[model samples]
Target: MTSGYGHGLDRDRDPLRRYLSAWIGFSAGGHFSQALSVAIVLYAFSTQSVRALMGWPGSLAVLGTLVVLATLSLVGGRHHIEWHGILPVSLIALFGFMGLSVFWSEYTWATVGGVAYAVGFGALGIYLALGRDLVQVVRAFGDALRILLVVSLSLEVLSGLLIDQPIAFLGIQGNLAEGGPIQGISGTRNYLGFLATLAVITFAVEFLTRSVPRRQAVASGALALTALVFARSPATAIAVIVLIVAGVALNALRRAPESRRSLMQSVFAVIVVLGGALAYAGRSRLLDAVDATNDLSVRSLLWARIRELAAVHDIVGWGFVGQWPTEIFPYSTIIAPSGRPHETGLNAFFDIWLQLGLVGGLLLVVAGTLAFVRSWITASGHPIVAYVWPALVLVLIGVTAVAESFVLFEGTLMTFVAIATIAARKRSWRSRLPQAAGR
Candidate 1:
């Protein structure tokens, strides 16, 4: 494969080639890869280690690493990123808004750090997209996921079968307690499911590409499926299923005539807008249908409280930093009254509104959706080499957004990377471009 920028990669002789190769090799992925930062943070969150280490000077070590990596990935690049595209601009705007929010945010220090975190991750994402091919990025994710899943499974086994006890520090609930949910090394069953969903999709793409041996593919698929089944998260289950369906749909879309595809997309967009309007208009009736009033499902009740919280800070939101601290004003004041843990918005869009208010939140939604849709359109026409990758990743991320805060959150650093890469202007730099430059 060739470099997108005109350059020879004949590392056997050229010192410059060797340097570029080494730079990208570590920066793109592996043990010392930029992804390491993300892995450490997820591990901390999964094991609830951060909470345990609260007040310690090195508590945010993982997050600190993440920020450094993100910043380095962007600032380390010799070539300036072209920020005109939807992918770059949306990310800049999203993080930029959060940065600006520091002026008005109650938690000023947290907001400032949060902005740096967002942009830092955003920077890494831009590098990944602009510098590498879809296959390489997927491989990096696959490598990281393998280690995570292995660690997670080991923890589950230790807690459930071997030790026959929950590991409170690691948040492993174990398989005991008769009908209890299995959290493994993840924070919750749903989070495990979420990771597994991403794994299966990654494995699927690798399988389609035939990049790995058949046995390895089969093993990874089996592993992901096993984890998903054990997770018991309805949302994660729906996400994986939707990913498969969307993949098949993208395949069909790619095969369609070029002109007709745009027409089809337009019609679908119209239908979606109308359906959303209808749904909003009859939301009360829809909520009743789910028996949410009496049962108060997790999402149902969370939404109910979110509305009230959002109303209190109608225009500019309470803050755009981290979670509403349990001890803080609006959060502490509302928790007992609402009767539900004021954790996350559960829905990405709702959460943004909770943090950034109506205007900022709407900007976040519009920018992100436009970027996703633009990627979708680009994938519809590009050759399968480019198209299938973004199509699958974008759809998976987009579908999963309904139930997961896969964007606009620090914990979702990896998701941000994936989203940025897929949404960036892509190229087949894997072969022709670099070779052309060499010649």
Candidate 2:
């Protein structure tokens, strides 16, 4: 009997390992590939020659999202089917309504894109909820996020070598008003802060997994990549700082004095390396090149527009990604090259409200926040906090959008929601186990 029990344990362990390995591989490949995809998109839009031909294209992310979702529909079908049981019914209905809204919306393409995006994310939520095991899913997510940090760092290095511009990986136009570059894989400056926070989470996972010194060194290197952005993007820097402080405080509360020592030491080392890099970068002329873009004040203008836009079309909403009245809508409120705002849609919640109406928008907020917070709690103690950080970062980005929009791009929203669903599913699974006799 003892021998049979031990063998059963081994059998279960093997399947778990296999699942974890596959999940990690998929996540890592997806992360790096996403970076490459972003670079291609940015390079296409930024070039003057291309711009003349593309004619603004009105949210390339949305188009790209449609293409990705369509592709995933075929390849991801099996995965989607597997997740159907776990997804929330209300989200599905909302997406249906969004799709229907396209018929009446002035911006048909935007409406189509919005509905498609909502559907894609809704699908992912289902997958996370019913199709996968939570612990394995998170472990895989951690592994993948760690790889993403490496990929992001690699791109930064590559960009530096190619462009010879410090902080150019951020893709910032180097204008004081710009705050930071818009490197796709690395993301915008504030996005970089989100990325760095992921790195921090990765470091935590690495420690949890008992990684070697070499891995630690790699993570340290990744953290240093954000040094350039820290000085340039107050938003990103502030967010990163706050998260770091929060993480530390949380750990202090959770850990014993002696156990906390190692984490503190590791964190201090990261700060030293990243801080030194920032000090050096701050002195360079490159630091002054962030003025042309409208990152900092763009949100104010966007907020004003949202309020104005919402007032007239307040009830029915304006369809997803629909246009606002630029003339009476406070176009001048935006800071940029006549029309170039670093990130035009400064707020996401407002965008949703404007497009979906007050009732729909409120429901989405409640549902989305619930999903995010629930996922964070379910996955926090697990190994997936690394990848989960990016989703959470999206949540933070969404918060800022209370006045403005976010990755409402088709499959992106679904991707994170899918993660949330998986987290929620895992929580339920854990709850099913019987406690040992007494509490």
Pairs of colliding residues, candidate 1:
1-430, 1-431, 2-434, 3-434
Q: Weakest 10 consecutive residues, lDDT, candidate 1?
A: 425-434
lDDT of each: 0.63, 0.48
Clashes of 2: 34
lDDT of 2 by residue, 360-401 (tens): 676666656655655545434444444344344444444334
Best-matching candidate per TM-score? 1
Candidate 2, position 256, lDDT: 38
Q: Indicate the residue-level lDDT of 161 in model 2.
A: 49
Q: Give per-model CA RMSD.
A: 8.7, 13.0
> lDDT by residue for model 1 over 1-439, one digit each (tens)?
4573334434445886577567654554434543554354344334344555463335456556655654445444535454333255566566667777888888787677666656655555655565445676666666566667777777787788888888887777887334345676666776777778777877777787776787888898888877777776666655665566566667777788987887877876686578668866985675565333332366666777778988977777877765445665555644533575566666777777877898777777666666577567776787754346655665666655676665665435445555555665543123344567799
The runs of at least 3 residues in candidate 2 whose Cα sits more than 4 Å from the true structure, single-residue gaps closed, are 1-85, 121-187, 210-221, 224-231, 245-296, 322-337, 341-343, 376-404, 410-412, 426-439
